[model samples]
Target: MSGAMRMLAGLYRPVESQTPYGGRSVTFEAMGSAWLACGARRRSERGEGDEHHAVETMSAETRDDPRLETGRVLRFGGADWGIVTVRPLRPGRVGLELERRR
Candidate 1:
């Protein structure tokens, strides 16, 4: 972690559980928190006609953590961001692609 990576983002992993009526439910469990160096947020609009949606994409870098993977959720900046992609930038450095729909 570097001085620039000042934001603390909480990592969450998805957990699948069974319901009382033989149904399945997916929930997120807190894994831990990590220091993230977040980049600028990019916004895009989609859809046609009277309906349109905005999708926000952001990139973040953090130390290598085996628990982090695709589909995990990151809680930061008073919002929950979905982990779109994860890649290794270099030794001990992991890059994450995060997305949030608004």
Candidate 2:
């Protein structure tokens, strides 16, 4: 599913993951090129706790995705972002509401 979808997708960007390697160590792995939305959190409507901080909702494909999880850290566009919520959008796709982690 991803192979065909990736080939057909026009916009692609980079996603980096930090995984715990041996309980006491961490390793950063680069998963090249993903289809995602990266931008400022919408101001039209927001829930409690969202208004105070600058955040963004990043949506990406879920199929074969191992980089997104609760408490997981990701680097996009040279900044660190923490995974706040990973929501399944539809077949072969998912949406990640990320909070900027400084």
Candidate 3:
């Protein structure tokens, strides 16, 4: 199970989170990354969310990592996004629910 995940590790984007070091200072730390499978969760029988877009699309599958915690800001590609859920899938893997910070 875990071996399957390891096979795809190279596909994941590296994400980082900053840790405060002192006054007005911080240090960047690696929070790892996951292969994101992006998609829009449909609101109804149609296909995608047409009206209520604020309700996040729910079907983003990601490579499971333990560090993917809710409320943590992960920096990806020079942008930061907040984690909404870190769901455990099979052993050694987790699904990450993320939302862009405003």
Candidate 4:
């Protein structure tokens, strides 16, 4: 598999966890571009709490599809971080599928 695919595939592995709400599937996406690293957390239906992570939406010309972009801001930690194009691959699978310019 390609480097990008390998990174995503590794992250897609099923993980077991328990939250205050209840037990739910662990779904998350992470990507690194240059010196930036961003990620997003999917909400678990089993839990009533709001998802802590947030994402954005974007459209691509080469790829005619919509995707969710996850990101956040942190001043204390370091530079501002942001997510750019996140899309669902299937029912319970999602990840980044864009090329970042250097």
lDDT of 3 by residue, 46-77 (tens): 23557433333243456566556676655544
Clashes per prediction? 0, 0, 1, 2
lDDT of 2 by residue, 7-35 (tens): 11222233445456634434544444445
Better of 1 and 2 by TM-score: 1
Which residue pairs in candidate 1 have backbone atoms (N, alpha carbon, C) closer than 3 angstroms, thus clashing? none
Q: List lDDT for all candidates, in order.
A: 0.90, 0.50, 0.50, 0.31
**In model 4, what lDDT does residue 50 have?**
78
TM-score of each: 0.81, 0.45, 0.44, 0.22
Model 3 per-residue lDDT at 97: 63
Q: After superposition, how far is residue 74 of candidate 2 from its true place, in Å?
A: 1.6
In terms of TM-score, which candidate is strongest?
A: 1
Screening candidate 3 with a backbone cut-off below 3 angstroms (N, C-alpha, C), the clashing residue pairs are 64-94
User: What TM-score quantifies how close candidate 4 is to the native fold?
Assistant: 0.22
Candidate 1's TM-score reads 0.81
Clashing pairs in 2: none
Question: Candidate 3 overall Cα lDDT vs. reference?
Answer: 0.50
Q: Encode model 4's per-residue lDDT on 1-102: one tens digit a residue.
A: 122212111111223578888867663443222211223323223324774433332222112122234432111122232334556555644544332211
3 versus 4: better TM-score goes to: 3
Q: Tell me how far the alpha carbon of residue 10 in candidate 3 is from the true structure, in angstroms, after superposition.
A: 12
